[model samples]
Target: MAKPARIRLAGTIAATALCAAAATEAAAQTPPDDSIVLNQQLQLGDVFSHQTLNVVDAQEQVTVSTSAQGNSASGAVENGSITVQSDQDMRGDAVAGTDMTFGGDTWGVVNATTQAQGNYLAVSAYDSDLTVDATQSNTGSLVSATSQLGDDDARLLGGAYINASAISNTVAMYGEGSFVGGTIDQSSSATVRAYNRIETQYIPAEAVIDSQAIVNAVQVTSGQTSGQNLAIVQTSTGAFVEAESSANSGNAWDLAGRARATANQAVLYNEGGSVVADSRQDNTAFVRAAATTTAFDFGRAEAHARGAANELSIGNNDIYVEIDNSQFNSGGVDVTATFSGANGYDVYVGADAVGNSVIGYSCSDCGGYLEARNSQTNDGDVSARADTTVAGSTRAVITGANSVGNSATFHVSRPSH
Candidate 1:
């Protein structure tokens, strides 16, 4: 009718330019020996009106590659928001070959009544010569509220690797929140090789009326076998709180390690409140080895009219090597506390061990205050152990080497005036 409708719109624009030139020559080739490669990006913004609310953003990226032998590569990202002002960023990458495997992941969220912020990053790399296994992971979260006030922030980073001959590496990070006054930070780092195994972690909880929950974590590894490294931070508040965890290792043999920091506070009319927890570990081992490090710091405070005070700490340190038939085993520092109103308290626990055959323990409780400390040192046929328990009003003190299959127990209930 009009010249055959202009030849059917010129054959649908020449088949959409030959399907966008075959998707740009299959994204410029290179990834085909039993192949798989992927790339992804997503962004969403726009939803406002509740007395002028604006600015919501999201971003993501993923890349993957695989070659032969049951090949696999994966990348993922998810982001969310409800805003007066909110921001988010996510990144991921994966590569594999020769009995190949790779995975990268990222998740993010932002809910703002006034302001919110988030950032997440993930990287995975494995180029095999055969026998290559690799994994990388990252997680994130953020929330903010302001009727006339603002601020909220979150960050996470992960890295994984396998560069030849028996490689297994893993890195992890996690975050959580609820804010009315802002300020929160979480961190993670990891490296792996040689009898490969490495882990890094951060756990977060925040309830802000005046805001504060900050955490920093670090993990590293290379060469000389054996594995395990952990860091944990827990927080709850009506006011102030702080937490910390630090770990280091190399040349490890049969090692189990831990670091924990915790805080809890409740204030209705405010009389005073503060809480802190810190854990640290350093390791080197050989000669029939076993190494254990535990550091736990806990705090609790509650106030209705007057008195409210709490502080707790735990520290364990080890440097290893026990020869002459070898066998160096050490577990040091454990501290715990539980407290209730109308004040009256002080508690501390400490344990230390060094070289040639050692074992140790330390415990503490406040609310009927209690303390325990144990230590061991040097040479062959060396042994030291201690245990203490106090329900209320029990006191203990013990010192060093050959406490001869040691034991100490105490229980006291206070309510007799």
Candidate 2:
């Protein structure tokens, strides 16, 4: 086998600069808006027989807006509107390495607004490391829109109004190395008034690995209107080791809103022992309304893991609605785990809604209107142990409706030993 490339951080910088330059040239040939906002691509062949270091640091901020108006002959404006928008796209790749250390950090932010019957919006997308093959260690942090919004409108409008997304991390790592530590964070917010609407949507986070990996932490937050979060991890021949995730959503006053977190893990191993410990936490709060209208606040958490000759443990927690509301709503939590490997054990735990909701409403028509529907569904705990040659066990625990409308669910499956 050929020796791996011993590239230092300086060499990595030089290589990245060259790649950026090439990308810039390619971008220049295309229409201004028809190109990717940011892109990073790394390619390496062969393992690093010697110790090496590779580092990448990047940061960016963007804002975009547009407005229009029409005035009548009498100097009165018939219609006036404004629109704000922002978007980001990123890509990266790395192939080849052993006994090497890699570090990277990328951060981005966006602010958008529209006034006078206008709308405000913000969006972000990340697609990093299409393919990666490193046999040693990897450490990095990728974050977007973490700070609180300064504007008054943004603060009042809440978390659902801002939209942020991470499409996926298409990476593949092999050999006996460990992922070590890494974090992926994304957040955004938007505010609007006067017959306006705000919406935020996020796709699931995805990753694939073939070696021992440890995810130190992962966090996501959404304010105001609506928020959604998801994560998926797959390992073909190694153990996940340890992982943790947290998701939160702020107040939502009108219409339908939700906050959710989900994780999926799959491991395939024929021999040897494997172990996984993954935990997830979710929170949704301050869903209230003064008018006699309908409102929905939902918080959910889910996880699934599968492997052979291994031990798996998972936890899911949710906090749904902490303030009183005149409108009807529902909130809950869901957890699931699956292990296909023989001679292994699985454990799962879940909790939902552990807080207070003070009531204060002064609307004359509230009594006349029918009370809003309120419901919380807790699936309870479930576990199954299937065929196994040696020894195996499955356990599940759940806590639901500590205060208000909160539900928790859990499920586990394993082969008998």
Candidate 3:
């Protein structure tokens, strides 16, 4: 009688295991119809997320998302602790997602979008210390983002002792409209570091499409500042698209731009250890690094871009169209960001509307562009170091434009190395 009962119990347990396995396989990460999710946990060690959505369709989407103070910190700790906090809120009737059709019906939506980030923190409770109180608070409602159409964007960043990486791409159409808009916004990326603290940001405003109007302003700096860079353009009719991107390697290099900008920066500047750094951007970008505030001291930034629009069909694409779009562009060999530091630099004044793209080259799109149109365009670059340290640099311009369609196009590059 005991043997028979034991056998029966084992069989029941086996059946339950099989049902549980089937349920797990059929499950999906589907949130509520109108959902509000809050997940708070202290996860020490490794973490990962994998999402795959096939032939999806979504539209009339009113997306009011706020992810402020989303940060991470990791490194060698001898009897220490790591803490991260975030607070965010949204208000008002913003003119967004109205009459806006993101992914239309019968329109296969494959959103293969990825935004990657990294944080490096080192602590020695017995010898040294590091404190990171990164906070950004907004008490009153202010209309900072407004009147945006097509592909418009805005970003703000701050922190200390970090490793960051970023990539962005946009195609009027890619892979049969499947990947029409592949924008990795921060919507962008960064890799920075400091044993004690390091603060850096690469802010770029961009827009694309026909009958579209775009205006961009950016500010980057460190300590005191007295430097200028200019890029001006005068157009004459037709399609007038422009993009100005910048990259830097110095522990402190002030930048100001009035157009689109981007970078894949990696810094390996060590004070009392060995460090090696590598920054890469490819077709299907995948970046993974385990570096240090070690001993190696090296950094580099390179950039590249190409544009084309064969809209010679009818007289539809009218008006002035300027593009400050950045996609799959790369900055030179290696970058240096001190993963470990004893003292941090206090930023004083960082201005906006700054540039002179470098360590990279940009190619102009052609085949009879801006035909029979009035255009006055200007592109100028100015660099002011303001009595600071300078590093390696290079500038490349593809001269001899075929014919600018009775238009004025000015190009200038000034490197303050």
- What's the distance in Å from true for residue 84, model 2? 39
**TM-scores of all predicted structures:** 0.19, 0.19, 0.18
lDDT of 3 by residue, 1-417 (tens): 999999999999999999998877766454323212222222222222222222113332222221111223322212223222222221111111111112222122111112221221121221112122211111111111111111111111110111111111110100110100111111121121111111122211111110111111111111111111111111111112222222221232222111111222211111111111111211111111111111011121111221111101111011211222112211211111112212222211111221211121111221112222222111322111111121322222111111111122222122221
Per-model CA lDDT versus the true structure: 0.20, 0.20, 0.19
lDDT string, candidate 1, 1-417, tens digits: 999999999999999999999988997784433222232222223211112222222233212222111111233211211111111111211111122111222122211112111122222212211111112121222111112111112111222121111001112211111101111122211111011112212102111111111112112111112111222121211121111111111211111221121121111000011111121211111111111221121121111000011111221111211111112122221222211112112222222212221122111222332233323232222122222222334223222222221122323233231
Residue range with the least summed lDDT across 10 consecutive positions in model 2: 69-78
Candidate 3: residue 381 lDDT (0-100): 24
lDDT per residue as tens, model 2, 1-417: 123354466688899999999999998776542122222222122111111222223244333232221100101111121111122112111111112111232133333222111111122212211111111111112111111122212222212222111111212111111111121221111110011112212111111111111111122222222122222122111111111111221212222212112111111111111111121221121111000111122122122221111111221111221111111112222212211211212222222221111121111222111121222232222121111121233233221221223222222212220
- 291: Cα error in model 2, Å: 23
lDDT rank order: 2, 1, 3
